[model samples]
Target: MIDLHVHTAISDSSLSISEVVRLAKDKGISHLAITDHDTTKGLQEAIKVGYEIGINIVPGIEISAYDYQRDKRAHILGLYIEPGHPSLNMLCAPLVQRRKQASYEMFRKIKAAGYDISWVDVQKYEGGTGVYKQHIMHALLDKGYCGSIYDDLYKRLFQRGNTPKTQGIAYIQLEYIDARAAILAVREAGGIAILAHPGQLNNYDAIDEWVELGLGGIEVFHPSHQEDDRQKSMLYAQKHKLVITGGSDFHGFYGDKPIELGCHELGEECIDELLQRIKR
Candidate 1:
């Protein structure tokens, strides 16, 4: 299988480059892409390991963007990007900063709510890389302030906690570029942009609108997507002439799921079509 969308430690993923590559090889993945969120830092080591293990590692990144006009959020996955592209790097910088600021604010809120958590404690969970909400959640759990390592972040940290008077707050506002802007940026940088995990978005109407925005592909295969959702995504892709992609979204040993690289299958035809589209 050619799994085009996986995460390494660069994102909220727990898997390191070596472990991801090792798992991919074991899973018989002929082609793999480590599309970590907002950063290409893991691409070098992942590429090196892919060379040693005979897997084709496509350089990719998952960028978060929002359509304020339509009041929607979208994730654009750029595949086969030029790693040294200055424009692409410039585009991702603000996103990283926004995420960091939001994380720190969230941490302060938790601490103010009488939780034995601090910004330093949350930073410690970063593993020197992707500083996402998952890291903050894990940090709180580690400090015995929360119940489990895989706590419901949206509920506990974002909403269900105490009021802002007793807690610091950080709401995820629309950041950087919108979906259309991200797609255009990737196109300018000589890369194909795909909608990553549309099922998770839970807004097919919005996706249909996105397909009209020059989105290059759709991620039809993802662990979180049910069979019915997968089928729906495939139909959408076929109807829109969008390239189809898939991945395990592996975050290493994050709970019960193993970091089985190509655990989610993508058809050979899907890979072929994607390549053809990129060539054009």
Candidate 2:
């Protein structure tokens, strides 16, 4: 099986790159992608471990982009990316800084709310990408402030719409690039831009709009997608002639659901089709 979407410590995930590669091998994942949020820093390490463990690691990244019309954000996954792509680096640099600032602000808010946490605590969980909200939550969990990650306790405190003021905790909104710009950046980096989990977007009507912007694929199989959602996505992909992909979206026990590596698989045909679209 091939997983086109996966995260490691470089993002908000608990697993390290080596650990993720090991788990993917154990799960019989012949091909995998380290599409960490906003950064490709883990791809090099993941690719090295994949070589040692006989798994093919595709260099990838998950970029956050906003839809101004709908006023919602979407994640765009770039698969088979060139690790040294200058365009990708230029695109992610500002985002990295933004994430760091946002995390620091959130930490300050938590401290002001009498949580007894500090930037040092959150920094301990960061895996070089930046301090993500998950790292903050991990610090909170470690400090016994939250019972579990993504639970009601977490949502009440950190979830959007339940701001720091609402939950009496600290929160800061991260910035995102325009969705069209994100897709163009992926293409500029010579990567195939795939819409990550259309069902999660809940904006199926906008598929054509993204396709027009050079979206090369769609995630038809995802842990959060229901059977009906998958079918609808498949139909949409066929209608728009888009490549199909899938993944566990694994975060190593950090998510609400217990998602195991290889739990969701992208078909070999789909993988081949997507690879054909890659510039290299």
Candidate 3:
């Protein structure tokens, strides 16, 4: 099996690089991609460990991006990326720092709202890059405030809303990079830039615009995509001659949904197609 979207503790995931890699390998994943959010800090280590254990590790990053015209989030996945490329490093470092700061501000807001959670409590769930809302939610879950990460408590605190009345109490908007820049950076970093789960974000309208800006592929099979979404994405991919890819998008316990690693059972040929585009 080939799972092209996985995360490790370098970002918001609960498992570290080695742990996730081992888990994927055990799950019959011959080809695995570590598309951690934003940062590529541990790609080399992940690749090294994968090689040592006889699994192919595709160095990748899921860029947190935005479509300014539609005001929707657009995440770009850079597959087979040159992890140490100056373009990617320069682009991601600032994002990691800013997101960490944003998490701190969220912690403050949650604390002020009379949540019995501390920064230290949340810190227990953090990985290398910084704390994410999932970490905070995990903290809340630990305190018995909520049943799971996606429960009502999480929605009340992190869901995006317009006015104070509807807005998530601890939510703060982080300025993501423009979709165009994200694709360009992925290309410049020697990777194929694929749209990551447009169905989940309701970001279909921006695909044509992004494709024109060097977007190379689309994620067709994901935990977030339904059968209708899969068909829609297949049509889009075929029309644009974009590569078809998929994965479990695993983050361990930090996952937005409870999903297993390599759950999609995608074929290994998808990686070949992605490489063909990179070669072009």
Candidate 4:
């Protein structure tokens, strides 16, 4: 079986690359991808371990990009891309800066609200060079400001546009590539362009619009995707000639949810077809 999407310590994920690779080998997965959010630093270690354990590891990155055509947020999963692609670096540089700045501001806000936290403390919680809100949430949990380490972030904090205070704490906005540009970037990077998880996005019409905007595939097997939702993506793939992909989206110990590695297995034929599509 093959699982196409995963995260490691490189991007707010608790599991280190080694741990995730070991888990994949243990789960009998033949192929896996370490598609960490906007970072490929973990791929080198994970790829080494995958070779040692006989699991085919595809280098991937989950890039956060805006969809100007749809006027919403979207992500593109770039598989088998060259690590130093000029466009990829250009796309990720601003995102990292935005996340870092946003984290600094959020840390100050949380401290002002009497959370006993500081930007330095928050930086220590960061899994990578970039500090996302997930790291801040983890810092809050570690400091005992929040009840549980597994509390809902959307309900408590980092709900995108939600207010933690009466006026709300100002957050940072990462500049991202639009749908057309993102698709072009993935293609230029020698990777397959697939929509990450449409389940989180409630807009089916927007998804269809993305498919039209050169989205080569859709994630049919995601952690939060129900059978019905899976079927919806499957139908979309069939209708749009999109390759269907699946994964656990594992975030590690920081997450309250339980998503076993290689939990959702893509059929061998599907994997073969996906490879074939990429070769073209």
Best by TM-score: 3
- Model 3 over residues 224-267: C-alpha lDDT tens digits? 89999999998899989999999898999877777888845468
Q: Give per-residue CA lDDT, model 1, range 1-280, as digits (tens).
A: 8778787776777767888888888878888888887777768888899999898888888887776666666788989887757767788888887778777776676677777766777676575444677777777777676675555543545642245553325444436567777887777778888888878876466667766666878888887789999999989888988877887777774533544667345557766776787788
* Lowest lDDT block of 10, candidate 4: 162-171
What TM-score goes with each of the models? Answer: 0.86, 0.94, 0.96, 0.90
Please, what is the whole-model Cα lDDT of each candidate in the order they appear?
0.74, 0.82, 0.89, 0.76
lDDT of 2 by residue, 94-177 (tens): 988998888788778777777887788889888888888788888889988777877665765566764445642555677887
Candidate 1 vs candidate 2: which has greater TM-score?
A: 2
The C-alpha stretches of model 1 lying farther than 4 A from their native spots are 127-130, 152-154, 160-176, 206-213, 255-259
What C-alpha lDDT, on a 0 to 100 scale, does residue 16 get in candidate 4? 79
Error of 3 at 47 (Å): 0.7
| Clashing residue pairs found in predicted model 4 | none
RMSD of 1: 3.2
TM-score of 3: 0.96
* Residue range 64-89, candidate 4, lDDT tens digits: 87767666787789877766688877
* Segments of candidate 4 deviating more than 4 angstroms: 150-154, 162-172, 207-213
Using lDDT, give the best candidate's number: 3
